[model samples]
Every structure is written in structure tokens, then in C-alpha cells.
Target: MSNDRSKPWFAPKRYGYGAGLPITWQGWALTVGYVLIFIGVINFSEQDKPGSNFMSVVGMSVFVVATIAYILICAAKTKGGWRWRWGGKP
Candidate 1:
């Protein structure tokens, strides 16, 4: 699939068993959106008031759901099917 770059949004890691930096705008946008949502959740975690605490149940729930969605999308978009790469032996 090295030469088939038609629909790949993320590239597989060279030495690890996951995705590397995004190779497309869609992947970058997804990553950035995920990070921004996480930060937003932390910054606005207080349900009653701002700057109170980080134990908001709603925030945690949203974070968990978003994280799961992000993981699923990443796994689907990443090239090589998230293969296990022991090293650059190939």
C-alpha cells in the first residue's frame, strides 16, 4: 500500500504499532479538533461555575465519547491497518 496514497489520511509509524503524523489535511483537522475539545473540556469542566474544579461528570462523559470516536476514526483512516512494527526491518 506504499504506492497507494489515494485515501490515506494518516501514515503508519515506522518503528511503532500505530499512526504517525498526519499526512493529509483531514487527519490534521481531526487531530487538532480532538486536542481542542480535550482542552476545552479541561478548561470548562466546572458545571456550576468557571475555574472551580475538574470533576464535572458531563465533561468527563463528553471526553470519553469523543476519545472513542477519535480512536475509531484514526484506526480506520491510518494506513497499514495499524500494523505492529518492531523496527525498520522491512
Candidate 2:
């Protein structure tokens, strides 16, 4: 916050742009896992099988909804600011 550029990237800033991501490394891991699940869902829905279109729609909807939820949770935790690390004060 004091214009100290030497701060670690994961450290929370006091003044500037506020916290970025609310979650910590664990949250990021979960996000990555979710992305993998999304990809798998899309791939399965693209197969040459019946109800592929319906599956695709459902999968996309789930992904979108989950993402929005995650963002909202992060925002709420960080008080509407970006955070580089998880937990603790923003």
C-alpha cells in the first residue's frame, strides 16, 4: 500500500487495487478442477450420441452458474476487491 513494489505477488495490497482473488491456492486448485470438469462435460456432449445437444446446454449452464457463484463468493469475501491470496484481511 505504501508503493512498495518489493511486496510478494501473493501478499495483499493495502491501498491500491484492493484484493484480486479471494481464495488461496486451494481455491485456485478447485477452480482448475472445475475447468477440467467443464471440458469433460463439453467433450462428452460433443460425442456422436443422442441427446448431445441437451447435454451441451446443461453442461454450459452448470459451468456458467458455478462460475458466477464463485465470483460472487470471492467478491463478498474480499468486500468487492481483487485479492492475490486467500483468507486473512483484504
Candidate 3:
């Protein structure tokens, strides 16, 4: 929404576009939660045999939606926003 860049929770990458590691506890929590949700979704979606090719469409859809939402939130919380960088100053 805005490029105010005030107290960002995530830092921008040094050499390329996108956010890097979390710079705040909130960011860390968000990342950890996402990972947990991802694992849960996969396990729940494939409740069949160990090597089954059956995946719940609903579970996969939820995962995809969550992933997109996470990306958008990360981009918004990243310092200097998301953009290309050549290892220069922010």
C-alpha cells in the first residue's frame, strides 16, 4: 500500500529481489506458522497410503491460497519493499 518503510518486520535481500530472513519476532512467527501449516496440509491431504497419488483437492487449494497470502504479507512487511538490488545500500 505505502512505501513508508517504517519498522519493517522483514529485511530485503542484498543481491536480488525478495525478502530475506525475519528481522523481528513477528516475522519469525509468521514464517514458522506457515511452515507448520504447510506440513499439516500435506499430511492431511495425503491421508492415503504412504506412496499414494491421492491428494485432497480442498487441502491443496487451501495451501495455495495460504501461500499467496503469505507472499503478499511478506512483501508488504519487507524493508524498502520488494525490488532488485545489486548488494548496494538500502
Best by TM-score: 3
User: For candidate 2, lDDT tens digit of each residue in 1-90?
Assistant: 474333223324555654444245644665576678778777866773674577777777888887787655444445444645345455
Local error of candidate 3 at residue 26 (angstroms) = 0.5
The lDDT, on a scale of 0 to 1, for candidate 3 is 0.88
- What global local distance difference test value does model 2 have? 0.57
TM-score of each: 0.79, 0.49, 0.83
Question: Per-residue alpha-carbon lDDT of model 1 for 1-90, expressed as tens digits?
Answer: 465545878988888687888989999999999999999888767444666544677788889999999888888888776888977742
Model 1: lDDT to the true structure: 0.82
- Candidate 1 clash figure, as a count: 0
Estimate, for each residue in 25-89, the C-alpha lDDT of model 3 and write its tens digit: 88999999999989989888868666764567767888899899899999999999999999999
For this target, which candidate reaches the highest lDDT against the unseen true structure?
3
Q: Rank the candidates by TM-score, best first.
A: 3, 1, 2
TM-score-wise, the better of 2 and 3 is 3
Q: How many times do residue backbones clash in model 3?
A: 0
lDDT over C-alpha atoms for residue 26 of model 3: 84
